[model samples]
Target chain A: MGVRIQMPLSLRERIGMEEMVEVEGDTVGRCLEDLTRKWPELKGELLDPNGRLLLRWTIYLNGRPPSSSEELEQYVSEGDIITLLPLVDGG
Target chain B: MEREIPGGYNGRILRVDLSRERIDQVDLDASLCRRLLGGAGFIAYFLLKELPQGTDPFGPENKLVFASGPLTGIPLGGCARHTVGAKSPLTGGIAKSEAGESWGPQLKRAGFDALIVEGRAHRPVYLWIHDGDAEIRDASSLWGKETRETQEKIREEVGEARASLAMIGPGGENLVRYACIMHGCFDAAGRGGLGAVMGSKNLKAVAVRGDRMPPLKDPQAVKRMAAWLKDHMDLVKAFSDYGTGSPMPRFEQVGNLPVRNFRDGGFPQVERITPQTIKGTIRVGMKGCFACPVQCKKEVEFREPYHVDRIYGGPEYETLAALGSACGIDDLKAISKGSERCNAYSIDTISTGMSIAFAMECFENGLLTLEDTGGLELRFGNAEAMLEMIERIARREGLGALLAEGTVRAAQRIGKGTEAYAMHVKGQELPMHEPRLSKALGLGYMVNPHGADHMDSMIDLFFSAFTAQPTVAVPDLIPLGMEPAPLDDIGPRKVALFKAFQAKRIVADSLVLCHFLPYSFSQVAEITSAVTGWETTPMEQIRVSERILTLCRLFNLREGITDEADRLPERFFYPTQDGPLAHRSLSPDEMERAKRYYYRLLGWDDRGVPTPERLEELGISELEG
Candidate 1:
């Protein structure tokens, strides 16, 4: 099933101008991988050299932020909304 | 004013009396410096001692103190921070707003640690300081000028291109309750309407130019810290690249960015006005404060619907959310223009936007109409109307006059049960962040003396123990006992953490350091000891913070702010209507408990007043005198 992937204004330049993109996968990680597969230019921005999700972003699955980046492999069902958000420490 | 001092300070305090047109210089005692350090700490000491109980905030008797910390003027990233403090005209309580730019460093180099301004001038004037010399100059020509124009005229009159100015604009001259004291074209001590205080005194601005450098006690250690900061550039590069608005997406995702005057959770047009989009569209360059590596200020230029000037500066995250999402406007160009207008008028963007949002909501509810708006349609998503309202507020024309008084006063003036819709805490409008999404922030809004200030304490989401999901740990906070707790729980652990972090924030503001800078508690303590030679530690720093907070609370209590006043708006009690956080609201009982627990933690009595024993422990028993 397809999940809706949303990007912030800051990421749209690198990931294209679209606010939300649709991708098919079973888990959060798989959907993200599929997202990168379609937009290869965004792979480095989302993941580090070691294939770990960058801590600079808080990947929210259906409006719920993961407790840790390790949970990126959590199951993602159809119609889920995935939002990529930057982590800001201070104003 | 020159005197020999230890490594960190210049050892001078400049005092100005507008009524007498007098200027006095006094040597700052070493004992005082050791006890209070500087910046907000010094402000708290002076305000508690010099100001009597129930002093009018805008009257001639009230005093405004401009202070800088020991680390200010040092060659380090985020070192150029300074603080402007006084009895808040908005909250009628103690208030301090910090600004980072060249002005603080210039003041330090001019041989002054602080400037205390009192009395009211018979005519418009500006205070000028250069080297160790100071004077009161006529500013009749600058009385009604915009902030940028006033800065230009002051610099030209002083004949120093490098001279820095802290000035008010038309908003201050007109006495807008939320007018801000602006520096250069962008940086501002933006809260509590201290600029209106400046207006009440007939003081237009303070300009300083200097070339002297203070001797450091441990230059090598300072250099090492600077090097450490440079090496850790990655910690703040994102801020420099995106300014503060880069995190808009994250805030929106969690329903932190209040849309349509807090009626909605998230904005559908967030992407159009985010930092990335603004950068790609109208951003020309990035700007930095004094000795700062993190250039977290955007320089934007737009020549479309409106001729947005880059000289007025671009919007920060709060500005974006306030003028953009909060108003239901997505046009980046319009938001940029609104930001420039606010800067030109020297009004606080948060209060200005939130005021407009309040008005727009009233309009939607049929409390106001186009006839009431002076023939302008005051509705959500009307970018043109919003832009017009900004200019009108600056000029104080018709409807603008009421709105310029700020949301609290405006709501009172329009009393048809409109107070419920006025989003304020202690008379000051809330910042862009919605407290429902972050409960700790809600607590902060309730307890902050300055009113709804997000920077006063730790935000909930940033807590080390935010959630059970692999939490991101900040090793630096471990010493202060900050760990992740449930994001929404106001449990004892969470309350304890909140109290601890609240102390830390006071320390940061007193030090006058940018909160964005990655300075650990230990690092801050080490740096303080190295710079001031007082042999400080994290524990001592926290103690000093508690003293400052207690003194401020005393000042507020003197202003009649009691337990009944220490509450949030009714809007915060009800569940959010829509967003990722829909149906989430703070428990009134738990909030009351947290407030009581926090008061107890700080050694204050049940009514939130510091006990005599606690005052003795804080070395401020004499304050009761």
Candidate 2:
């Protein structure tokens, strides 16, 4: 079973999905790697060419941030909900 | 004009009589100029000496004062902000607020410290200022356009892209009750619907480009202030790095950021939309406003087509709250889109979003129907629906037209118990903070001369008392730092003291300091002394700040507002689902006690009016005349 990786509110339109983003990976990094592999539209939305998570993006594994020790495969379950949030700001 | 190259000002105030189609210049009294600084201070003097009473807010008699303070046009964390004060069309009272960077400093250096536009224009007109000279030119060509277009048009007309433009949109022209006055294309004087006031005057926009530097009293003083400011480079970095969104987690974690229009502020989606989320998703590069070091204004781009797949202003916390979860929209893209529309249409995001939220709640509760919405579901969380509504509101079309009247009025129209859900305090929608979580902020909203605004005196950040502290989920989450003043210890006296202090600091910040400077009193005091000769003693500074607050109160009072207006929305007064503060509010007894304490401390009568004694204390005894 794979996990679902969703784009944040700000980038959801470009990626074309608000939720249920299916991806294959075993760690947070791999999950993102898989996420970009499928929804290539969001590559620049979340990371630079080097694949570093942009300063404004944060990830949640099953409603909570993944534990430091847990890799993508360590916690990958069929129905895991991985949410991506962006920090778009101005008043 | 009196020229004092260093002490405080550039020595000139620009005045435009739209009815006469003439622009005049005057010198600001130097001694009073230093003490008052800029922005609100200048507005105060203008209101007293020039903008006489009996003048209609919309008629040719009203005055608009835009001034940058002594500390403006400098390279500080708090960049210079221009102030706009005139009799408010929304509340039918005096309204004064700070419009940020791009316009204020340039207007000041162009050889004028203040710009006062008075009288109604004979035709659609925009002001063009080059250096000290300003002219009210025919803007018929500029009519029937949006703010962004107006900016571009003015740029082409003036032949300078560097010029500053503050304009209104169709919403303003139609006189939407909560329209905004947008400057620098992003920032705004978003409350009191000042844009509507501008529209009523048939004023189109004011564009300025100047080539002059400020006259510092002491170059060493300027250098020392700059050096001292450099010492706090870490905070400066943090603020710039995060822009104002850094506070998203703090407010969300603390339960301060209002969600659902102060209805249940704890959005399960908070973590997803935090500043970290913004930084990772759409931020392309760091952007600054004018000469600001802590460039908090972000230019966010939404790629691809959804609702807001274009370039425009990014979403600040207030905008996110206003357009996001407040209306059940969790998508960051939609929030950014909403912010952009507000700027494009020149309307207040807080009010417009709340207006939509108000509509959503009514429809969801079955109080409103599809027929009422003219086929649009008007459902919460519908991004497409929101986009249509924003356009409609700006054009005053269909359901959008109904909502453009504002939440308070719309709720009243939608009957069937919708009033209970209307999230307005004194006809203005609550701006993005759940005051129940923060009593100081609650009190600030209660006492804010302009309806429920967090900008006036957001003491909630420092005191940290009333912020939402989720006890069960995050056990280590304590709302405040080590030593926070408690509600009782911070009785009405201390609360008033804190409120007054924050108001003064706000006056300074609103005029000069960046809203995100986030300094303690000691830091602000140090900066104020180094730049200008005005020394803010611990006690005296706090009191003087309180005095400035009282002046705002007096301005409102003179314009016919009173104690009954000091209020939190009835919704915030009760609990939908209690987490932190519980189902507790200031009981009628407690509220009375707090009000009495505040009144006594300020020497005001129980009615919240400034007593004659209070005016005398502030050396404005003649204001009663």
Q: i-RMS values of the candidates, in order?
A: 10.3, 15.7
Tens-digit lDDT track of model 2 for B1-625:
2235334467787888888887788877775554456676667656755656566777778887777777777656565677787777666666776777478778866888888888888789888988878887788987878777888889998999889888888878878878888886687888888888788779989888887866554567666656765664433454466566554554554456666556664566665665557777876656667765666666677656654423355776778778887787777777787788888888888888888888888888898889888898888888778778888888899888788888778877777888887887677778776666556666767776767777764443333222232111111111111133453333544464555545555556434666555454555555566655556543455555555567667777776678888776777667645434446454545555666677677778888877887788777676564
Q: lDDT tens digits, residues B392-477, model 1?
A: 88888988999988888888999898898899989888898888766777778888877888887667655423223423334466
Per-prediction DockQ comes to 0.08, 0.06
Local distance difference test, candidate 2 = 0.67
Q: Which residue pairs clash within candidate 1?
A: A67-B469, A67-B470, A68-B469, A68-B470, B464-B484, B465-B483, B465-B484, B465-B485
**TM-score for candidate 2:** 0.81
In model 1, how many backbone clashes occur? 8
